[model samples]
Target: MKEDAFCEEGDIVLADASEDVDDIGKAIEIVDIGGQRLVSGLHTILASRIDHRIVVGFGAYLYASSGVRKQIQQRAQGAKVLGISKTQLAEVELAYPTEAREQQKIAHCLSSLDEVIGLESHKLDALKNLKKGLMQQLFPQDVA
Candidate 1:
């Protein structure tokens, strides 16, 4: 189904079709949507206006899924390298919590983990910079 849908902020976008299939299908982008950022030149599928009762936190689910990714790769190999159609993308299954409360809990947990990872990553970068500086101090300036 060709989506006549306009992407709004907070919608989950998946590059349903891409020339390079391996790295393309795994990440789900959350549109900070209502921006001047016009996403063109690439085809994507968005899961918008989701029913909280039936599905919750699809963005996180898509991020974690492997089976759907395999299916997308298989589909992409035969289709135009440019991308897959919205209808084909729609057929991809997502596993998400059916209940709203469970979905919130899962989303919270993932958010916390992401925050910790970001902090640790910043620390690692600082340590690397310190090591580089120490190494430079120990060595004389390079002669031509």
Candidate 2:
């Protein structure tokens, strides 16, 4: 298949056909799937937003924003594997700034914050590793 047919990075994928709907609606922006063709699991969905910023923001907001989750929950249904039809997804109201530039700005700010959070997490992990190493060196035997 053509590379263009593959799911693009930052594309939001919803696991609509999963055992638990709680785990659905995932935002896929990782590098591993870059330019990779997606088979789209049974009930998995791939949506291409008419506006990049709106979808990106909406995707990011899906998990954290109770309001958005409530909207999705309203439309979601299925006994074994909860799923929301495309029509139901469309029925969910989207609240984005009227101007595209505003949407872009908001996305930019949120992305920047996310990067900082990632960096901080890495630093904390590194510090923890260093402390562990020092402890091991100072005490050859277990300190129980």
Candidate 3:
């Protein structure tokens, strides 16, 4: 495999194609490689920062931003499976602060918010399950 094909820390792997239209162009940034050789699979776009302008961890969230997502969804094609070519992917412009510090701050804030959201979601699921159990015990089903 070519060296460029391998994913490294800070690289963003984007889903260029997916059966679900909402999933088109979704991306994930590789924060750590863990000493493993990682490569994006078929139907993915491997993106790496050519310069230090865009800080690490920014690309993943940038693609998820409203404007970028709208652009991606608009450009997505096909009936059964949506897809975007390299050129199409490139056409989705991103707006970011020119300052590296600003970019870092934004990425950090978003990451922290994501962590909180995950914790809250788990708690919500647990509460829902508890409520379900309570309801079942309170009102038993009549056996036929």
Candidate 4:
């Protein structure tokens, strides 16, 4: 792959193809590449922050937001596999805060919320497992 193909920190990569229309334009922010040459796959659209209009960690949430997703879904066209071209993606309009500090705050808050959700999900799973164990103990299966 060419040097230009390698992605850098804070770059956003979006899925261009998916069987589910709602997932066609899902975006992921690359926070780290582990010091390796990382490139987006053929099925993804790499978007770099060249103009610095949107701050880091914000594009992922921006693209995932309902407003931007609706535009992307409307632009997507396909029967079996939904797809969004670079042109169509470019046509999708998005709004963001002008102040860099505001963008940072939004990203931080969202990211912190995500962390909390993940922790809660883990606790729920553990409780479910404990319940299953208690149920097994309460009603043991008969052995032939």
How many clashing residue pairs are found in candidate 2?
A: 0
- Local lDDT at 88 for model 4: 95
lDDT of each: 0.62, 0.64, 0.87, 0.90
Best candidate (score: lDDT): 4
- Candidate 1 per-residue lDDT, tens place, 1-144, comes to 233355544465676555676755555545454465534225566656454343344464555568777776666644446466666667777666666777668777877888999999999999999999998998859856
Q: Candidate 1 vs candidate 2: which has greater TM-score?
A: 1
Q: What is the lDDT of residue 123 in candidate 2?
A: 100
Least accurate stretch of 10 residues (summed lDDT) in model 3? 50-59
Model 4 local distance difference test score = 0.90
Please provide, for model 4 over 1-144, each residue's C-alpha lDDT reduced to its tens digit, 9 standing for 90 to 100. Answer: 687788988788999999998788899998878898898988999988867888878878888899999999999999999999999989988888988899999999999999999999999999999999999998889756
Residue 141 displacement in candidate 4 (angstroms): 1.8
> What stretches of model 1 exceed 4 Å from their correct place?
1-4, 26-41, 52-58, 78-82
Which window of 10 residues has the lowest lDDT sum in candidate 4?
A: 1-10
Task: Using TM-score, give the best candidate's number.
Answer: 4
Count the clashes in each prediction.
3, 0, 0, 0
User: What's the CA error at residue 129 for candidate 2, in Å?
Assistant: 1.1
- Regions more than 4 Å wrong, model 2: 1-11, 29-42, 51-64, 142-144
Per-residue lDDT of candidate 3, residues 16-113 (tens digit): 98899788989888887899999989989998886766788887888789899889888989899899988888888888888888889999999999
The local lDDT score (0 to 100) that residue 78 gets in candidate 4 is 93
